[model samples]
Target: MSVSIDKTNSVVLSADHITKTIGAKNIVDNLSFDIHQGEIVGLLGPNGAGKTTTIRMIVGLIQMSKGDVKVCGHSVRHQFVKAIRHIGGIIENPEFYPYMSGFDNLKQYQRMSEGVTESRIHEVIKLVGLQDAIHKKVRAYSLGMRQRLGIAQALLHEPSILILDEPTNGLDPAGIREMRDYLKLIAREEGIAILVSSHLLSEMELMCSRVIVIQEGKLVTERSIGSEVQTDQVTISFRVNKTQPALEAVHQLNDVRVIGTDTNRSEIILQLKEEIIPQIIKILGDADVSIYRIEESKQSLEEEFLKWTGGNRIA
Candidate 1:
């Protein structure tokens, strides 16, 4: 059932048919997924979609009513503390000592967080781009900066996976860009798998390799980003030709359609079925028509997410 990187590719953290109930009302119902090493996975849902509840269960902050969770192959229930080695997480808003310097705050976290050290804290601070502001007190930090510090703390022990809830709650455009870049960098360089719950679907489309969408605590969709490879999208332009040849060529292939076109310049969308797009390009080239360029029609991540989930709230 775990098909995407969130649950399939050498799984680092996985939930097997997990359910959570509070006061006789089931909040999370039979949710399941896995997070793989070195992948960034996004969890998206509308309000009251059980996104938060599922996240809490992953972090072990709440007991699941059914099924089980595993972190890096260790059962979260059976191993408890030991299984936590596989992950680091921050739920909702991250908390820190407002009066303490970021360095001091990290130091405190270092003392409490197992298997962390002074040097490790420095490393994490640098990792989050907080090297220049390490000695600054949390009270002076901006909301975005505080989020980075929270991430630095989360990475203190160098866990294989990171789980975050609403990680970008209070950041402006610049801050959001910074956080997005930094998270992508860490996921690529540190080989850390990240699972983030967010309402920012567009941003997640750029940062995540795959996405798991939930609606009303039930799994809506899980899909791999940019997984389709088509060889038929062609670049075409007519120097002094009629639009009829282009129209005729499009009609030749049932999957072919127009993307954009102007008086002189034109683009076509073609899905490869029987042959490569290069064949079409060759045919057009043989017709003595000057070709400008040809390129594949790359699918927008947002479009894929929307298509996969159609993830609006249901009444």
Candidate 2:
């Protein structure tokens, strides 16, 4: 599916029909998407689903056999130096010099990248909430502190895009929450587009605005997670006097699936469109089944992810 971006060219990162092939196998097939400024997008798929391969191609770690990746209007393949300047990324765990102080570590990176001023470094240090510990040695810093320092280093050059792979790995609950909030803040305050990849579906739900799901190296679906029920289809639990009759009546509706049923309690859970709820009630009433109560529940991201991945465990 094609994602529509703003016509004003607000897209900071775009993978246009990106494909990766290894010998006879196609790892990524015609994958395309856009991440606009101030947006946080999640790259999600089951293990061996080409999530890493796609990310690697975007960062120019591996070459794409076909198609293109553009960052800030510069082609990654043709204008490697120009395109790379707009991106700040942390692939897997971020590395740091354990003997060096956090401030010194950032200063060292400042030397590697042109145009990183000392004030910008301090600004990013404050942005990541490491002001008090900026002088502390990396060896004395916790995993979360090091992660924040990595982010600060990435931000020093003021890149337009940030890509993080499994950024919350090895973090505690509190640390994870801190990382999530900081990322959102950066996307908003810095007006930068951020793309994150992780196996934690629940955390992705909380952190990402939209998610792209790919399966077996193909795009399965892309969806928004801000609303409880983002799609037209919803899961509703119906309580009635006769479970058999209600089930029989609901089965008559098109595009409806009966997922769970309890005969003793006369309850049945169905996945269908919200607009079809009234029709279902009429059908059950016409069937002479006394309707007790109907409750609509939002499908969690993990449930939707499983549905898209065909029950494959996301790793």
Candidate 3:
């Protein structure tokens, strides 16, 4: 479950000091980051945080006012076709003809994109978990199923990079989880670099290994999800029979910092480590406090995201 980023991985997508100016306003200001092979990076921001603008620039849909975005060592602006050949994306909801069957829809796309063979279409269909329902008409498919089919179409050419914006917009909880797991599986199994833009903070926390957050069209922070706090201190929470006694016991320890006490739940939150837990428990035991349960409770991605963005609500 360790998702610590490996800096040695080859970079598949590079945005070098990209900026987009509209009249007197700077929509995106000097934003830069890299997405490596087999990595899933989340593009997070508020309603007007330039997430879409940045995606557009990378996919060559909009012209950049300054700087360049390169995919597989090809400049998006200079070599549009060559750069885009390595990319497959769904900016918004994926579209397919309601009258057409899922297999037929993919077949039409295969005709349009060169080298998208029948075998490749079948391969992508299975990749997205649509093998059983692929012959069904598009009108009968659920929103989640359509989303999967859309992803299948995008992957038909086996692009090196996958870009998705608001990918889980209308999905139910189960659908969201399914999409999250599928994306992670694809990134690991195929070594495709994935850039996902979504407002679902919890999903991103579980799915992406790294996230690049932007605020006011500028870089706010880039962080790894599970190890945001990898220093000496580790946050832990203890539920005990006596909350006051547990707090008192843990507060007396020199290394442990008592964050807060939840009297209602008979719990105490503190920052310490595995080795220190035994001492804390011993102190509690001597004080007649019975430990019911103990677990690590790190600050969620939503909490840290709000801190980084100055409480600006994400869309």
The lowest-lDDT stretch of 10 consecutive residues in candidate 1 is 259-268
lDDT of 2 at 41: 86
Write the number of the candidate with greater TM-score, choosing between 1 and 2.
2
Error (Å) of candidate 2 at residue 181 is 0.8
**Residues 91-134 of candidate 3: C-alpha lDDT, one tens digit per residue:** 97899999999999999999899988889888888788998999
Give the candidates in order of TM-score, highest first.
2, 3, 1
Clash count list over all predictions = 3, 0, 0
TM-score of each: 0.74, 0.78, 0.77
Answer with 1 or 3, whichever has the higher TM-score.
3
| Predicted candidate 2 versus true structure: per-residue lDDT over 137-236, tens digit per residue | 9999999999999999888899999999999999999999999999989987898889999999999999987788887787776665553332667878
Runs of candidate 2 exceeding 4 Å displacement: 5-9, 227-297
User: Per-residue CA lDDT of candidate 1, range 206-230, in tens?
Assistant: 7787777676677765655422223
Better of 1 and 2 by lDDT: 2
Q: What is the TM-score (0 to 1) of candidate 2?
A: 0.78
Residue runs of model 1 more than 4 Å from their true location after superposition: 1-9, 226-315
